[model samples]
Target: MDTDRLPGCYRHPDRDTGITCTRCERPICPECMISASVGFQCPECVRAGSGTGHHPTANAPRTIAGGVVAADPHLVTKILIGINVLMFFVALSDPVLARELALYGLYRDYFGGTLHGVSTGEYYRLLTSAFLHTEWWHIAGNMLALWVIGGPLEAALGRVRYLAVFLLSGLGGSALVYLLTEPNVATLGASGAVFGLLGATVVLAKRLRYEMRPVITMVVLMLVLTFVPLGGSLSVSWQAHVGGLITGALVGLGMLMPAAGRNRALVQWGTCGVAFLLAAMVIALRTAELT
Candidate 1:
């Protein structure tokens, strides 16, 4: 605090100065001072200041984007919901479009012979069906579940892996329906992906050492409601739900496994990739059998 004992400039010894950095209280010369609303800070202190003044979330992982420190708010989930909502309107406006988009089971071959009840011509329907909803309530219910689970899972798994989980889960659901159900039964909705997220949450919660009783309870209730025949007009495709849950649980095991010396993120991606490829291969084989 005494000027007499004040040291010379940090960068130069000849020039003496009394100015000090407000943050670290280090002596700084005029040339080294960076003026601010509160006071002047040294070049070093200014460089390290929390740019926003307010601190970020405690213990939250930090990501840098556009030269700014920010927390990933899981925008992927919202984007997915937006896509589904948009598709819902499109499907609602044209009811015939929904049938074309739906994953119709492969019940018979082109020649009307037994073909494991799976369709062959419209293989793309497997993935497209997951995005289509029958009506307002259909999209609303799926989006509600997605809103609840998607953000947190995306935050935990990151955008790419989160997308893998949803998409692969949806494919798993459709693949199961195509292989197991009759061609007459048509299925569509994001329920399979929502169930997949639910299943992944169970695995993730267990790994994080958190209380999973609430999550498990919700799982049971959802599964029960899924199979319990909500109304005569609607048929619940339990096969797809089960398939998606199983796929999600498997993917979560790889994604949340204990880390070793290897680059674990890469390993997680590999795991998801292999699962996706396997789903695709299976769908291809199922469709191929018809021809």
Candidate 2:
């Protein structure tokens, strides 16, 4: 037990050692001792000291299954709704702003009138139209949907991802309208982004293992109502709905994929980036077709 004539290593009884484990104070040779912040520790002490049941071999770092979660105040959704409300008031003061922001079916229709203006090739209309609404009821319905869908999505996917899905899905919807419908028609609303949330909700429902038939049923009914030609003059842009739905679902699927990096947060953001890129590719292909 004396330092002058140290005891033999417990692991190798034939070898004499002076070093001892920091935690358990056991006699350990250099080969068996692991370096720690305080002092050297034996393999058993290292394993026992770790509370997470993770085993780290010599020269290897510990592996963790989880990382810190961010606190989301649901700021993105609130900000979006605020911007939409402010734009609505501005449009009320000047009616021409609404016409300027609306997405035209034809690439050529770009003037300051309803759908009859000259085509100005204003490509930004694809995204701008999503923020513009026609009437009080139109905005109210969309804002309600955003509140319901955006909060949970922001919590689950974080603010950046939720925003990406909204914008990309909106773009997807606009691209669809640009491709299918007549150019003379004009469409305005956040229905595309709202429908994107619906599609994402469907995927989240499946992943979260909740019964989604009611949501599905509602979606189907809405699709039917949108496409079915009514005897009246009321019009709905079914193309936006279909486009947003498909894009959101794809992005959700990407989220479900097993993440690939040591940093969980980085991997999540990367997944969202890939999803956005895919959506952009879809829009690019559609644009190529249109050209």
Cα error, residue 152 of model 2, in Å, equals: 1.3
* Superposed model 1: Cα runs more than 4 Å off: 1-72, 106-118
Per-residue alpha-carbon lDDT of model 1 for 172-227, expressed as tens digits?
A: 88888776776677788888888888888788667644556778999999899887
lDDT of 1: 0.70
| Prediction 1 TM-score vs. true | 0.70
- The C-alpha TM-scores of every prediction are 0.70, 0.64
Q: Each model's RMSD to truth, in Å? A: 14.4, 16.4
What are the lDDT figures for the candidates, one per model?
0.70, 0.67
Query: Candidate 2, residues 1-291: lDDT per residue as tens digits?
Result: 454555766887764556677678888653455555445666677667675555543323111111111334377889999988988888778877777777764443346743332134467888988898767877887899899877666555555667777887888787787767666677877888878877876776565444467679978886787786644322678999898888777766555333323464565556567756765665566456544
Best by lDDT: 1
Worst 10 residues of 2 by lDDT: 60-69
Clashes of each: 5, 6
User: Candidate 2: lDDT of 22?
Assistant: 69
Residue 3, model 2: Cα distance from true site in angstroms:
68
Best by TM-score: 1
Report clash pairs, candidate 1: 105-183, 106-117, 106-118, 106-119, 107-117
